[model samples]
Target: GAGVSQSPSNKVTEKGKDVELRCDPISGHTALYWYRQSLGQGLEFLIYFQGNSAPDKSGLPSDRFSAERTGGSVSTLTIQRTQQEDSAVYLCASSLGPGVVYGYTFGSGTRLTVV
Candidate 1:
């Protein structure tokens, strides 16, 4: 893909249901990231994957949230037992590499609503 791509642009799930968000990063990019944005809140970093290094999962709000990157290309973010508070737009981005220099190319995002 020319830029980052995310699947199922919108999702509406019942509370307690599980949902998975997928991201396909640009080819040759070495860094990938996941973020969340609430209605009026700033973007929240959820995870980061750089090259072959271990993924950074520190920002995940709880154990119910998890993510993984396969072949350093595609990534998936899964949320279990969805709660109303979890409703937000899930964004994915990829950069040429880590640091501020490369910046990031972001996906439009997957909007999840827990009803």
Candidate 2:
């Protein structure tokens, strides 16, 4: 893809249901990231995958949130036992590398609503 792509732009899931959000990053980008944004809130880093390096999972709010990148091109964010608090816009971004200098390309995001 020319830019980051995310699936299911909108999702409404019942509480306790699990959901998977996908992301296809731009070609040649080695740095991919997942973020969660509450209404009118700043992005909260969720996870980061850079090349073959170990992913940084520290940002995940809990074990129920996880993500992975495959073949260095696509990524998926999975949320288990969804709660109302989990309702937010999940954004995916990619860059040439990690750092502010590289900037980032973000997807429109998947708006998740857990009721």
Candidate 3:
């Protein structure tokens, strides 16, 4: 079983541009999550998907940030309009289920830098 992996690991864009971050989660895992972590702010859950359904979208900062899970495995996060305020580590994680009691693994993250 492979671990969750993220692409680019770093992204630099200008204000109002768009960016996409990719994630490949471990095989057989049914739950996936996206989070944002700023310099001082710790990990903040962005969205969570169980199987093919996203039950929570409360953490998404704005319309600019969105994500989707495919076939209950791979996932991609898209930022419609990148802003300096959107600069942060976009982290991806996967687990066996939805609850956070345990069993989640995180990717190194795609660091988005809006310049």
Candidate 4:
């Protein structure tokens, strides 16, 4: 893809349902990140994957949240048992490498709503 691409720009799911969000990062990008932004809140880092290294899941809010990057390219974020509080915009960004020196390209984001 020419740039990062995310599927399902907006998703509305019933409470307790599970959801999967997909992200296709730019070619050659080694670092991909997942973030959540609640209404009026700053971006909250969820997970990060760099090359072949283990993903940094420290930022994930709970066990219900998990993400994985396949072949160091596409990434998927799965949320189990969605809750109303989980309603937010899920953003995905990719960079050439670690750190912000190379800057990052972000997607429009997937808006997840649990009702």
lDDT of each: 0.92, 0.91, 0.89, 0.92
As a whole number from 0 to 100, the lDDT of residue 26 in candidate 1 is 93
Model 4 residue 103 CA deviation in Å: 1.4
Off by over 4 Å in 2: 52-54
lDDT of 2 by residue, 24-93 (tens): 9999999998999999999999889997453688899999988888898889899999999999999999
- lDDT (0-100) at residue 31 of candidate 1? 94
Task: Give per-residue CA lDDT, model 1, range 73-103, as digits (tens).
Answer: 9988999999999999999999988886958
User: How far is 68's C-alpha from truth in model 1 (Å)?
Assistant: 0.4
- Candidate no. 2 TM-score: 0.95
lDDT per residue for candidate 3 within 16-89, as digits (tens), equals 89899998988988999999999789999899899878999899989888888889888989998788999999
Off by over 4 Å in 4: none
- State TM-scores per candidate: 0.95, 0.95, 0.93, 0.95
Kindly report which residue stretches of model 3 are placed more than 4 angstroms away from their true locations once superposed. none
Question: What lDDT is reached at residue 98 by model 2?
Answer: 83
lDDT of 4: 0.92
Q: Which residue pairs clash in candidate 4? A: none
Sort every candidate by lDDT, greatest first.
4, 1, 2, 3
lDDT (Cα, tens digit) per residue for candidate 4, span 1-107: 89999988999999999999999999999999999999999999988899745458899999999888889898999999999999999999999998869788999
